[model samples]
Target: MKDKQAKWCPELGDFAGPKYRAIVAAMQRDIQSGALPPGTRLPTQRDLAWSLQVNLSTVTEAFREATRLRLITGEVGRGTYVLPGNDAVQLYAIDKGGNHDTIDLSTIVPARAFSSEDLRQSFATLLARDNLSDIMDYPTPDLMQRCRSAIGQFYQPRGFHPRQSDMFPCAGAQAALFAALQWIAKPDLPVLVEELTFPGMKIAARQMGLRLVPVAMDEKGILPADLDRAARASGARTLVISPILQNPTGATMDADRRAAIVALAEKLDLLVIEEDVYGGFTKEPPLSLQLAGRSILVGGLSKLVAPGPRFGFVIPMLEGNEARLPEQNFAIDELVHVTSWMAAPIMLELCCHWIESGEINRHMEWQRQEARTRQSLVRRKLGLPPLGRKPAAPHLWIGAGQDSPFAGLSGDQAAAKARAAGVEIVPASTFCAGRMLSDGIRLCATSPRDRADVTEACKRLRKAWS
Candidate 1:
């Protein structure tokens, strides 16, 4: 089946004007009548041309027709394949069961912000590369270097600078965090995280058999003083913090606070794991703690680029560059053990294409504007409290107070109430870490597909909570 020279001959039939059309018609008949089964290889253009006494172009045209009919798939390096379907194996099937009425305000992803044209164009450019085959193999060190170099350029203008050697590609921000945690977290020694954090961190800490030491915070991220206090008391040597547009609670630490926190981490000899997942949406990112030598930066293209790609990269400070604290250091071995060092090839390639082409910046701008517009709509409709200064950020964190609408209810009950009212929101409980949890809910502004949907959801929220 690998060699096309074995020559598959479907006898050319009469009643067709064009030889190519006749060839296509014969192919369909043979396939339908069980003369040729699914996965049966058709002859190579040249071989088929010789056998049928037809020109190569004719055979090529016929193959294209067959492929267009979904009877085959043409790979670049690999020969055309009879796409196994009908009686053969189906590669995939669409999941048609999903509720359409609920306006989801929990899942934070772009709503109709990306264009199919742009995605297709990026792939087309990727396909044009002569070294496309090289990408199919385990991503080579050189390819990773390309990603690092590209990543460095992307973040450099935003004030994040990591030596290319320090940067490594990962599957997503979650992967990077999980990998680094496996290296540092011990059973008794809990790792420090924002009291209200992205749920992934808690899940990872649990799976890795490490406890979480919650650091108290306010409107601005983890309070520098509180972070130091928790780290010192718990003897936690590492900190996973999201200073830029933090999740569940959209808290951003201002420049002075960020510097203070980084200085405190340095003072306490703590390994600061800076999660910069939401930094790309802003034009002027405050100085990242990742700038410090002891910081492990976890960043990715999920928020800026499409989430399906799941492209992420980790930058572990170099050996000499990190603080000399032995407890704070992470090794490459732990990362390899955590992720098995596998990154998605196709998505990574497409991401590299966008970064190199400078399309990512343009796309990020659109997303920023889109997110802002949605937030404005919700703000106007609900008269909600200021989530933060950045309208470009996705979620709004609201507290459950006694005087507040859902007075006696917990976050889960409030969330259920919101769902019954025709919209869905994430309970604050989902993001809570340890006893220092928030009695709140996170309304992600970018979940609904359109502005009307977002507005409708907000109206429902007001009806439920007001």
Candidate 2:
């Protein structure tokens, strides 16, 4: 006498970790998505296991984990109910005091920069291939070879060339990071990172039981002296670095600094992990840490080609040791097994076609141009000076300088003003590593759908804060 079909049962898509943990995580994702709102009743363990076609013990363990997170309640002689998470609810608030229209700049995503272009030709060409069936299957060694070759070719002109034998396609940047963590970190080991870095890396580090030690940085980027001190002090063998157009703070290291950091890495015997996701957007990309010595360099198409696919690659560098690739391949195999080894065949073919036909280069140019134009618009319309800016970088900052008029305003206060203006800006705390240097906000230079939207948002920003 109940609607079984309508009840919450997780669609556990190719996820890593234990089955029980996956269940808890999936339920949390659903709860945060508002699919299972507060006070909603969940099916009993037996009912859920029967409905989901899983073992009873799995459901019981899942329910126990969910209860531990305070995401659900188990009542005696009654049923389970979703718990309240007001903080989580605030994340997806669309209606701002009764308005549905809002320009979101809080998310770090590439804009649809290229206009007058369509994917019809891409798909048509892909569909016309004779080996279309093989493309959809899990990544075989042959397809991986082609993908790695394509990735290498794309990066060759940019100064960060990678060997195809060492490269393998991953789901995304985070996937590569997870594999790196598993290979380098043990329980309770310390890992060094930029004071302000990608938040996803921080989350992954915590999940892997690695402690993130924040290294100091200067205007040009991570200070070599501080890195040495931290590396020696914490005895951290692994360091995660983003050299070009760093997130939250748009710092780009010069050649001298890159060389210095490399020297320190060799001296300290550090295992370097370079995240060069924004490499193509920069005019003079730095040499990848892989070139220096033993390291891991992550490359992805999501930032350049399009944001739709979870397409990325990880290259394990050991300076042609011949013995290291096998171990690295083993780690990659584990990741692939857990994450479902292949990207969609269509995505793989599209990337290859773009690389072979040289169309991806044109797309990259357009994205860079679009990003610069947006940055200029933000400066002119909002009358805000950009801090830590680089050419064609997709994100920029508006900091409160010591003697500036806006010094009294906190990042949260500034963000609230932008929100009232129907725009959402990321707060400073979102990127804080160990601490914050100043109160500021990061604005996505290429997130809005169009220039007019950003212009209007800037106008509202000026009216509210300036």
Candidate 3:
């Protein structure tokens, strides 16, 4: 009975489209219904083909589809088995220091750069405006254009110059990313991403029912060769990348790497969605992927100023390009409409005021210095080496591979241990896009407001792994 149960096969009842797709659909349905539980071994492709009276190639295609959706995994000695992806949870939604007992370092938030009095003054400034009632009303096209113009002025000095015609303000960077996905990605299709990425992207992609194909990466983010291979293999046209101050690993691609990546994207006809939320931290950040015609640039003040205002913008580099498609323009218009509709006019007004009044710049300068200070404290507490010439990121990565101290432990186990020690840090698995496991964890130095809290948290983390 156990042997028979291991060789599970899906019933191909009346379905639409191709028979291969029907097989995949049946598998999904059965999995959802709990008929095929996680870890259940699936029948061989040949056996399933014979059982369903279908061709071997058809079963192969079905297995390929299932694998791409992260539904099953094939082992060398062992057969293919169902994955527990359907039961996976989103890790990006943080409660934000909800429990005082737990020093939460899991969420990557900028340190508090302003006090309550400063906030009150900002509100006072906004309240003192003569056009208060007009600001409360819905934002008109001209008003929004004014907001974009202010944003453009801000980005111009930061090495990213966007065409006024190509920009759209969003509620936040996450909102901009989702809007970009809606504009470019087709549902149920493959979207290429770095093997380890922002947990929010993973959550958004899963919610949209898109398969994320993980491209291999190095110390400088995603490799161009691996990206090319993954694009060809998966036939994915969209690639989401964080070139500077990448989360978890803190890898920032240099000028040469960025050029190589943009060139590869052009060669593959790939649509690059560049997430540059952390670019403001760099003193001399390299040129952005916005230079490419097939790229969408996303930046936010959440990581720079604060998460409260929820302000960001998206720009599609299609203005005055001869290769621009009519449908692409339509998509951009749809994106602008959707983002504008979803974003709060009041919040946009407040953030725009901050941007124009230079309040955001003060916050950015404070965050830049404070982040480096906290990073040094964490390093000293953890007995880690100095970053030296390498630029410092807001987060630090601790690897637990064979050569490391925490060698036998997985990312989940490390995180669990940290929690038991009354500290919160995110594991590598939370950022992983595919089934590949990583025995590493990420600690956000800037998440906590005080350097002493970061110090104590690092101490607890050391004890947790000791």
RMSD of each: 21.8, 12.6, 5.6
Q: What lDDT score belongs to each candidate, Candidate 1 first?
A: 0.70, 0.70, 0.76
Task: Show where candidate 2 strays beyond 4 Å.
Answer: 1-99, 114-117, 289-291, 320-342, 385-389, 402-405
Tens-digit lDDT string for candidate 3 (1-466): 0321455666676678899999999999887886875556788889999988999999999998887787875544446766545322544455555767788888788998789999898788878978778766667786688778878877866666677878788889989988887775556667888878887688788778777877777788898888888788777778888888888788888778888887887678777788888888886543443345777788788888888888888888755442542224244667777676667777887888887888778888888888888888887777777677776778888877765445678666888898888888887767767544344788889887688888788888777877
Q: What is the lDDT of residue 118 in candidate 2?
A: 57
Q: Give the higher-TM-score candidate: 2 or 3.
A: 3
Residue pairs clashing, model 3: none
Q: Kindly report the root-mean-square deviation of model 3 from the true structure over all alpha carbons.
A: 5.6
Give stretches of model 1 more than 4 Å off. 1-97, 284-291, 318-323, 326-330, 333-340, 386-391, 402-408
Best by TM-score: 3
Clashes of each: 0, 0, 0
Clashing pairs in 2: none
TM-score of each: 0.74, 0.74, 0.83
Model 2 weakest 10-residue run by lDDT: 320-329
Against the hidden true structure, what lDDT does model 2 obtain? 0.70
lDDT per residue for candidate 2 within 60-122, as digits (tens), equals: 999877765556654443466664442322434544347557887766677785444457777
Query: For candidate 1, what is the total of clashing residue pairs?
Result: 0
